[model samples]
Target: MVRLTPAQLWRFVKRFEARVLIGLVLATGALWTFLNLAEEMSEGEIDAVDRRLILMLRNPADPSDPIGSRNVEEAVRDITALGGTALVVVITVVSVLAFLFHKKRIHALVMAGAVLAAWASSDLSKMLYGRPRPDLVPHEAYVYSASFPSGHSTMSTAAFLTLAMLVASLEPRRRSKALAYVLAALVVVGVGFSRVYLGVHWPSDVLGGWCLGALWALVGWIVLRALHAPTRGS
Candidate 1:
């Protein structure tokens, strides 16, 4: 094994330190966005824009009916289900098992903890915000809680993105990492859009959820990287 000189070792430590700094910046930005949205929502400043955005997806003649065909509406509902509590739980369980199978115990723990924390945080934030569901259009899907930050968007983004990072870590190729993140982004975007399309959540709600969930997932990934640092080389 080639021994790393003092200069090279210093450079390695600095690189990881820079990564940690970037992670902190990203987390701060996400939390700031969520708080700003919550404040605006509480002041009712975002309601008009939320209603207008929701209405854009509905027919002028009928706010109850989404502009898409029945098939598309059904498809949207199915897509939204992927972010529902049941589906998120199932996916998380499977992912944890897969990580364990690969002997990645730390990854599995982080994955489970990050998603559950995001899910709980989403619920708590919803209750704290107590923002009502959009009244601008009829809901195309069932909803049970307050709608400031969409639970589906939050949980799905947390779970799916964390899962993506776990899978990407197993590969040492840039293409694999890019593909994993791309797929997770697609899922997050789709679920967020579906929430708005169904009129169960305001656009701002989805935005807040995405921000919060991404924050938690990024944190988990950063922690994993730090824990695995000893095994890393320049």
Candidate 2:
């Protein structure tokens, strides 16, 4: 076996170091962007795009009338339930238990912690903002909380994305990993859309929730990778 020359080895080391630095910078940028969005939202600044989108979903003649048929409304309600507190709790607990059963205690614990943190963060943001639910249209679903940074939208995204990442990490095939990510994304998007369609959350609320949820999921993924790395000098 031939060993590399000193120059070649030095170049390789520099490339590896560069990659790590780039990754750190990207993560920092993402965190900064999320914080900026939250700050703007907390200051009661509603973007025009958000208002237009919400209005489009409502009947132009009557804001009280949502623009969907009865069956469609029923389907949307069912989809939204997937992101409700009851279902989110059940899914998280079951997923954690399943991870433990597979002897992945670290993964189980990480998931549990990530979900709890996400939930607490959502609740705290809601209280801090105290933004009320949308009244432009009659709500199709029952709601009883401050609405900015929707809890269902945030929790569903965080929980489902974490689960998807965990599943993808275990899969050896590229196709399997792609499928897992796509499915997770569809679930998150559908849940967020359902909230707006049901007239309970403003478009901006869902947008903020999505941003925060994605950030929390990214943090979970990073933590998992760091934990799985071999200790230095090992």
Structure candidate 1, residue pairs in collision:
none
Q: Indicate the residue-level lDDT of 93 in model 1.
A: 94
Model 2 stretches with alpha carbons more than 4 Å out: 1-30, 229-234
lDDT against true structure, model 2: 0.80
Model 2 per-residue lDDT tens digits across residues 56-99: 99889988777889898899999999888899899899999998
Leading candidate by lDDT: 1
RMSD to native, candidate 2: 6.2
lDDT of each: 0.88, 0.80
Write out the backbone clash pairs for model 2.
Answer: none
Error of 1 at 127 (Å): 1.3
1-234: candidate 1 lDDT, tens digit per residue: 899999989876865677677887888898999999899889989888998999999999989999879999999999999899999999999988987887789988989999989988998998898988988877888888999899989998999898887777777777878898999999999999999999999999999999989989988878877776322221
TM-score against native, each model: 0.91, 0.85
Candidate 2 has a TM-score of 0.85
Q: Enumerate clash totals for all models, in the order shown.
A: 0, 0
